[model samples]
Target: MPMKGLIWFRTDLRLDDNPALLDAIDKCDEVAGIYIFSENQWNDHNESNVKLSFLIKNLEILEKSLSNLNIPLITLNTNSFKSLPKDLNNFSVTNNINQVFWNNEFGINESKRDDLSAQILNNSNIHVSRFDDQVIYEPGILRTGQGKPFSVFTPFKRRWIENFDMNFLEIRKPSALKKSISLNNESSKIQYSKIHKVDIDLWPAGEDAAAARLSNFLELKSRDYNQSRNSPILDGTSRISPYLALGILSPRRCILEGMKLNNFELTSGNKGICKWIDEIVWREFYRNIMHSFPKVSLNKPFQDYTDSIKWRHCDNELKAFYEGRTGFPIVDAGIRQMLTEGWMHNRLRMVVAMFFTKNMLHDWRLGEEFFMKNLIDGDFSSNNGGWQWSASTGTDAAPYFRIFNPITQSQNFDPNGDFIKKFIPELKDVSLKNIHQPKQDLFSSSDYPAPMLDLKTSRLRAIEAFKTAREFNNS
Candidate 1:
């Protein structure tokens, strides 16, 4: 019997630089691809409608790409991860697949599903193979001097650079297989709702689009990225995040292209290029945090002491923040940007998250969940890491007392207040001096609300709460 293989496509939606897909092609006379449609799983993870829609579109393109390579794409529906293992095993057995391959996903639930699928497949005498394509170094590969997973990013980054090799960036594109795989794969349109208000056109689909975006960013804006990245109005940051989130682009390909511009140096050369690469490594570090410390994946704070912090719950405050009427122009602008674009500038994400968790004295989990539910480019690890960092509840978090004043941040990053005006049209008429914090008279005239809370009082309140939590933890 000719060897038949199955490739389980999860986050990895593209073929280029996909180890599992390439390995399946190399090993089997015939290959098929499988994608599981689990709406419940998506809901469990607080996945955004925009992201789901983007995923469906990408899968459609991926199916066509796989067809050209003589592989059939099969989509299976399961309620959740609990049922996925059996469904996948049945599909493998029914199709007489001798081997199954997939790239690793570091999330707790994903890891469990993959493990169960492997167990059931192995029992049925089907060979199972897994590869790591998400991170240059597998999640748990790099560790501290004591063989422990490094919890802090700076040390982890230092270790990552020390262990890095230039050859790790090399990627191969798989060619068309010798023979075609004939299978009854679903050719119907994916069932997805168009409820997301985000303009999907903002993000072009497919690997080609992703590669083009990266190329354009590197060619045009990368040199000035270090200086311009913090400015919300500047198109300095590479918006390849959505592509990376969906696996339409591989990190290896991104780093390789970046290195080509800077003499192939990872840590040295242009400051902007190096900084851009650091962001990629930060993604890898978060994956490591998820893999090594599973508690974070379970919604628990990495720093357990933080759990004692009493987070205030106020429906009016949450609603105001959500509707972008929080009266803090900079913070509201960030919220409105996410509401409209399904994306927010990196600087604003920090400012908004800090204001939510610290100034508002709300739970970080609330902000984190809201971000994931609205962001088109949301990755669980990155979003969670960012929220926890801002909340002072995660590894290498900002010091509890080091709260960012939204007004100061606004003045520093959005000095011209163009970003504030662009997203908050009610503030368009406000002078530059009052753009960051409109006067009461201006708010009354424009229908913008007054500042919800006194910044100084709220700052003191947050500090006191953290101190109380620390005392409780120590006691």
Candidate 2:
């Protein structure tokens, strides 16, 4: 009898550089692909409808790609992770599958599900193999001199570079099966009540589209990325984040292509190329943080002192912030962009996050959940890390005193107010000087509200709050 293997697809959706998929293809005479849709799991995670739609669209594309390789993609629908193990085991038994392979996921719930699935498969006399394909360096591999996981990113990145191997980025393309296998057609339709307002045309699904976007960005805009990425008006940064978040594109492929542009130099090369690679490393760092510190995944702040900070509960303020009615032009613009596009610029994300956590004195988790509910590129680790960093509650977070002045940030990053004007048409006639900090007369005339809170006053309030929390925690 031929060895039948199943490749369970999760976030690692792409064909190229997929270690588990390649291994399955090499080890088994026949290979089948499976994707389980857990609506309960997605809702529990506060996943966006836009992201769900994107996933379904990409699965359709991936199905065709797998078909070409003579491997059938069987879609399974499960209400929650609790039933997934049994569903997987039953499928394996019914299909006479001898082995199962999958790429690992780092979330607390996801880790538990995989562990249970492994046990179920093993008890059923099936071999289960998992690969760490998400991060170049698997979690727990890099540690500080004290033999502890580095909580800070700088040293983590430094050690990451020191332990970097070019072979890690090598592409692994799967060969086609000698004989075609057929399975019952399974629809990948995902129906959710809440649909996002984002234009689907802006983000097309598929690996080819992702690869093309990466190539275009590298060929045209990568060289200027360092200088231009901070400016929200220019399309300097690679907008392949949604693809990356969905695993339509692999990080290995991204790093490999980026390295080719810089002659395979990870650190010493074009400043722009190195900076881009740094962002990739930042993503990996967040993943490692998720793996090392599971509390962050469980909605606990990394800095224990932050848990004592009294976060304000103002529904009106949060509503205004969410609806882009916040008086701060940059914060309002960023929220509006996210509402309409299902994505926001990286700089704007920091600005808005800081304004929420520092200026509004809201809990970082609130902003984190809001972003996850709306962002197409949302990943738990990155979103949580970013929010906690802005709130000074995470590992290597921004200093509590380093509150961003929204007006100053607006003037610096969006100098001409082009980005703000683009999103907020009511401010189109406002002058550049007043755009960042509108005068009372202009603010009223343009129908834009006055500054929500006094910036300096709010800054002091946040600082005092953090100080009190720290002192209390220490005492």
Each candidate: RMSD: 1.2, 1.3
- Deviation in Å, model 1, residue 413 alpha carbon: 0.5
Cα error, residue 76 of model 2, in Å, equals 1.3
User: Which candidate has the top score in lDDT?
Assistant: 1
Candidate 1 weakest ten by summed lDDT = 185-194
Candidate 1 residue lDDT tens string, 126-200: 999999998999899898999999999999999999998987888888989888777654544555444788989
**Clash count, one per candidate:** 0, 0
lDDT of each: 0.92, 0.91
Residue lDDT tens for model 2, 166-185: 88887867889997654444
- RMSD of candidate 2 to the true fold? 1.3
